[model samples]
Target: MNFKGLFRHFTDMKHYFVVVLVVFAISFYLGWANSDRYSFFLEGQLQGLKSVSQSLSAKGNPQIWYFIFIFLNNAVKSVLIIFLGLFFGVLPLYMLVANGMILGYVLSLQTNESTLSVVLKGILPHGIIEIPVILIACAYGLKVGMLVWKMGGQLFLPVERRTARRELANVFRLSKTLIVAIVALLLLAAIIESTLTYWLVHL
Candidate 1:
C-alpha cells in the first residue's frame, strides 16, 4: 500500500473530517445535557447493547467472541456508511449523531464512577483508535455524498461532468486504502476493548 499517498489523501479531506467532528461534538453535548429527557430512548439502546454483550459472553472464550463481534460490527458499519454516503450523506451524519449521543448518554449514566476513571479505563483504551477511524470513514462517506451531488448537478455539463467523474474515481481509490487501514485499526481496538478495557473496568 502507498502509505504516503494514503496519508496525503486523508489530509486532503481535513475539511470534511472537521465537519464530522463538529457535528459529533454538538450531538454529544446535546445528549449529555439532555440525558434526563432522552433517558428512555438512550437507555433502551444501552439495554440492547448489553443484551448483545451478554449473549456473546455466554459462549465460551468470551474475549475472542467479544473481539470478533466488536471488530465485525464496527468494520461492516464503517464500510457501509462510506458507500451509503451516496445517498446524499444523510446516513453517515445520522450515524455520527447516534453514536455521539450514545456515548454521551453512557458517560452521563456513570454517576457512581468518576467520569475520568471511566474514560481512562473503559473508553480511551480502544476509543482513541476506534473513534477516529469511524470519523475518517464518515468523512470519506461525506465526500462521496458531495461528489454524487455534484455529479447530479453537472449531468448536462460535459466539462464539469468529466471533472466530477475523475474526482469520484480518485475518492473511490483512496477509500479502498482507507477501508483497509480502518479494519486493521479496528481489529486492534477490539482486542484492547475486549481484554484490557474489560479487565480495567472490572477492577
Candidate 2:
C-alpha cells in the first residue's frame, strides 16, 4: 500500500545481488557478443511459421496471441529465476551464467550492424522493465533462503519447545507480494516484446 514499505521490502532482500549480476552479465555478454546467432534464432522461428502456413491465421492480426505467448515467455523466465534462487550458491551462478551464454549465442543470428540498433530495436524496449523486475524477485528469493539459514531454520519462533504457537505470517505475505510484482513486470515486458516488437518488425 505504501512506497516506503515496498522499498523496504525490496532493499531488505539485497542478498541476491551477486546472483543477479552474474546472470545479467552472462545474458548480456551472450546476447551482445553474437547478435547473428540471436537473429538466427528468430529466423528459425520464422521458418517454422513459414512451414506451418497451412492456415490463414498467421497473416491475421497477431494481437490475438499476445497474452498467450507473453504468458508462456514470462512463465519460462520466472522458472529460470526461481531455479536460480534454489541453487543460490556456486551452482546457481553457473546455471544462470550458462543461460546468459546460451541466450547470447542464440540471439547472435540477428544481423544488425550497429550494436545500438540491436539493443534498441531488439532488446531494450521491454528489457527496460522486465529484466530488473526479474532480478528483484530472484534477489528476494535468495534473501529469504539466506534469512532462513541464518536463523537456524526458525524464521518464525523461538527454538525452545516451551513457546505458544505464534504466527509468522509476515514472511509469507512479503514473499507473495514480491513474487506477484515480479510476475507483473515480466509479463509486461513479454507483452511489449511480443506485441509491439512483433508488429514493428513485421512492418
Candidate 3:
C-alpha cells in the first residue's frame, strides 16, 4: 500500500532514526559499562521478565506460547509508542533507552559461554530484524512528537500552521504502512526467537 510513499517518508525522517539509534547506543554502552553498579536494579527487571517467561511456559506448548507472547508484547508496545509519542516524544525515547539498557545489561552478565557466542546464537538471529523494526517505530513516533511540537509553535502563524497540518496528515497516512511493516517483521522475529534462537541457545 503506497510503498513508494512510505519509503520517501522514511527517507525524509532519516535524521530522527539516527537520533534514536544514537540514544539507544549511548544507553546500551552505559548499561554495559555500569553493569556492576546497576546490578540490583537490572536483576529485578530480569526477574520480572523471567517470571513472565516461566508463566508462559507453564501454559504448555512453550514455543507457541513464547511466540504469541513475544509477538503481542512487541506489537502492542510498538503501536502504543507511536501514538503516545504525541507527548513530545518522551515516552518513545524513554522506551528506547530502557530497552537498550536492559539488553546491554543482560549481555554484560558473566556466563559459562562467551558473549560473542551468545549474541551470535541467541540475539543475532531475530535481533537483526526486530531491532531495526523497533528503531524505525521509535523514529516514526519521534516524528509525530516533533510535528506536534511544530504545530504548537505554528499556531500563531496561519501559513506555517497550514503547512504543519498538511505534513502531519501525510505522516499519519504513511504511518499506516510503517505500522504494518513493523507488525509483520516483529511477528517473523518472534517466530525465529521462539524456535531457531531458542534451539541454538539451548544447544
Q: Each candidate: what lDDT?
A: 0.89, 0.56, 0.88
Give the Cα error of residue 54 in candidate 1, in Å. 1.4
Better of 2 and 3 by TM-score: 3
- For candidate 1, lDDT tens digit of each residue in 151-175? 8888888684457778888888777
Return the lDDT, model 3, position 5: 88
**Which prediction has the highest lDDT against the true structure?**
1
lDDT of 2: 0.56
Provide the TM-score for each candidate, comma-separated.
Answer: 0.95, 0.63, 0.95
Clash total of candidate 1: 0
Instruction: List residue ranges in candidate 3 displaced over 4 A.
Output: 159-161
As for lDDT, the candidate ahead, 2 or 3, is 3
Worst-scoring 10-residue span by lDDT in model 2: 161-170
Cα error, residue 55 of model 3, in Å, equals 1.3
Model 3 TM-score, all chains together: 0.95
